[model samples]
Target: MKDAAFGALLAIQFLTRLPVPLACPWTPATRRWAARAYPLVGLLVGTLVAIAGSLLQGLLPPPLLALALLSLWVALTGGLHLDGLMDLADALGSNTPLERRWAIMKDAQVGSFAVLALVFHLAWKGALLWALLAAGASPWWLVPVIVLGRLGAVGLLVAVPAARGEGLAHAWQQSLTRRDLVLAAVIPLALSAWVPGGAWLALGLAAFIIVYGLAVRRAFGGINGDIVGAAIEGGELWLLLIAWSWWSFAMA
Candidate 1:
């Protein structure tokens, strides 16, 4: 029980900007168990963002409210996934061999491709949120989308072969067992019981997980931390797109 509690804290500590009052142990076993709690971290982030959006829904214009929500989203995660997205974008856009592309991803300096990807990513998120707000959709829609994003991350961690022999992803992968995946999946499974169109959403997420994992494998020969982070951001965007499209279809 104590180790599990500390594992949760370790996950929260590593994944978010939120300060954990308790010190989580820095150990391999702890990090391994920590992955199981990743979905819960997403739930926490999503719930807080939803509540904030609900409170601010009518007070601010849709545009500004969307901006505020987006800001909060980025602030909470400290742009960790965004940085990975940027790094991957730089690597992909470098038009070099895989080895050189990997090197570019390691570079500290941001490139034009990274800048462009950042703008597009932020713009799409803000635009989609603003549209949803204007349509009077419940901000609670964010809960599943955000939760699924991290679930996607966890899914990737286990599914993709670790490209490198080192780093956090590899260590977590090495420690993972099927039981660990079973535990990690429990959150989403419970969440599906309540989320609308849950079955369909699960199907979509599964497909994304499979395709995204393979794409990473083919492009980079396997997965790493950056690829997993990219999966999160990409998964979130896909969910948002689905929401917006569904709304449009219903209205049309």
Candidate 2:
């Protein structure tokens, strides 16, 4: 249990670039468990982001607060998913075949399509978050959304096969076990229970994971680190969009 907890915290540190007071000794087994614990990192990220946004509530307008929250989120994660989003966008936009698309993703240069996609994705998220805040969605809602989004992404890691021969996804691809999946499922469910309207949030998470699973099967042939990142960003955006829409309609 200590190893598992440390592994989880290590994963959080890796994903969020957050400093920890203590460091876990790295081992192959611990590294494997770290991959399994990656999703839980979002719980920590969400808590910090919520605290920041809530604190800024009185000082900043809704749009500015949303931007600040979004910026903090990207900074916390070191823009990992944003890079994936860009790479995926560039690959999909190319006229080349699947083999070439994979090659394109390997290139370090960001293409026009990638730039456009990043802009749209970030803009959409910022606008949605602002709209949610303006609609008077409670800060409590953000917590579950963030936590569930990451868990939903983790579900993808377990459910799909890696699309590439190498990368972080490939490195720990074999780490996932039946017990790991069970633990992942349980953690999010338990955490969701703490939030207001959490049942709906959990339902949305289930739906997102289900849909992403199907999409991964059809689109990417399987999952890679890129797809996992895409799932996390996409899930968060989808949840925020739904929440904003609901709030807007309710206000109407």
* Alpha-carbon TM-score of each model against the true structure: 0.95, 0.89
Model 2 weakest 10-residue run by lDDT: 192-201
| lDDT by residue for model 1 (117-226), tens | 99999999999988877876778888888887888888888778888898778977877776777798788877866876555556678889999888878888888888
lDDT of 2 by residue, 75-110 (tens): 998988888888888988996787888888778999
Best candidate (score: lDDT): 1
Judged by lDDT against the true structure, how good is candidate 2? 0.78
Each candidate's lDDT (Cα)?
0.85, 0.78
Tell me the TM-score of model 2: 0.89
Q: Worst 10-residue stretch by lDDT in candidate 1?
A: 243-252
Off by over 4 Å in 1: none
